[model samples]
Target: MFTGLIETIGTIENYDDSKDGVVITITDCSPILEDVHLGDSISTNGVCLTVIEFDEQRTKFKVGVAPETLRKTNLGNLTTTSNVNLERAVTSDVRLGGHVVQGHVDTIATIVDKKPDGEAISYTFELRDKEFINYIVHKGFIAIDGTSLTITSVDDSKAQFSIMLISYSQSKVILAQKKIGDTVNIEVDLTGKLIEKQIESNLRQQMNNEESQLNKLISSIVERKVKELMK
Candidate 1:
């Protein structure tokens, strides 16, 4: 689990393909040798990756990306110098900033438009594949490329949102590197997913209860008719 608070803008230093998977090296602006170790989970571009090795002193870290993760995230397209949002897994005592992020990519959304809205920047991204859009809700929270943002508007296949880029968000994350046509990974809020599940579960329970009641009523009527016929 993660807090969605980006620690720094990490750049891809190197990537090598091997038979099993790809080994990735990343460099970031965070404090040197900040105690990150092997097996630590890092949120890279809204996707979770495990650290296979680290050279914190040299400001370098490495992760082994499985092919399955590559298929679900934009990490596969990474090359040397690709900047990404970086965040480590939260500790027990850290403040719960942002929202709960599983670092799981739901689907890919394309940026159709970007413009300024008041003091913030409004981005319009088209939601392709109805299955992905079904999870989107207006004013709800979403994490795109590991940066948590709120939805401002919604259409059949498009979503619009204005995000205020405070100084911290601008400096700590990779917003400086964002371009119009670039594709980023997306992760929906865990709260929204759970609420969706609850709704479905409640509806199924109600239907089952109604069916049981209907069956009992029919049995009662049958017994009453049998008594009347015997009389």
Candidate 2:
């Protein structure tokens, strides 16, 4: 798992598209690659990718993205010069700076508005997959391009939400590079998803139990009526 805190930004060096999938080579990601191995996982633009290869100098690494992942995220639109948020998987020893981020992007969202909010910047995004809004709540945690942010406001009907980024976050991550209409990978809070699943499961089980009891009651009543008629 990952914490939505971005470590640094990495520049895309090359994008190789094949029948299998796309292979992305990024350079200048030394910070994340400091203790990296061949199988280490890295969050690239909020997508969890395994390290397929890395340079001896630890300046660059290559990750292969499957077609399904490309379709779900904005990674397919990345170019050679595109800068992406980079984060290494959190270790058991480090403090959880940000909320739990699995790096499993659910959908892509489009930036509808960007404005200055005092020293911070506020961005409003419209989700492409509106169904995911069910799990998003105002003041809840959301990961945009792997940066964990709290939702300032949410328009549930319209499937849009706004988030404010402090000056430090804007300067440290690649959010500054984004503009209106640009798409970003989105990962809603994991806790919310788990809660929703549990609630749904409980509701289904309760409904089934109620239905079974009603059936039993009807059968007992019908049997009594038959006995009275026979008598």
* Best model per TM-score: 2
Best lDDT among the predictions, by candidate number: 2
List the pairs of residues colliding in candidate 2. Answer: none
Give one digit per residue, the lDDT tens place, for model 1 in 1-231: 887888777789898988788999988645523867778898888888888887736487888888888877777889999888888888899797788888888866666666655555566665434466666677777888888877777675444333445544666776545667666777877777788899899867766785666566877899999999999
lDDT for 80 (candidate 1)? 98
lDDT of 2 by residue, 20-60 (tens): 99999999889888899998999999999999999999999
TM-score of each: 0.82, 0.91
lDDT of each: 0.75, 0.93
Q: Residue 113 in candidate 1 has what lDDT?
A: 69
RMSD of 1: 5.5
Q: Name model 1 segments beyond 4 Å from true.
A: 29-33, 56-58, 157-168, 208-231
Misplaced by over 4 Å in model 2 are 211-231
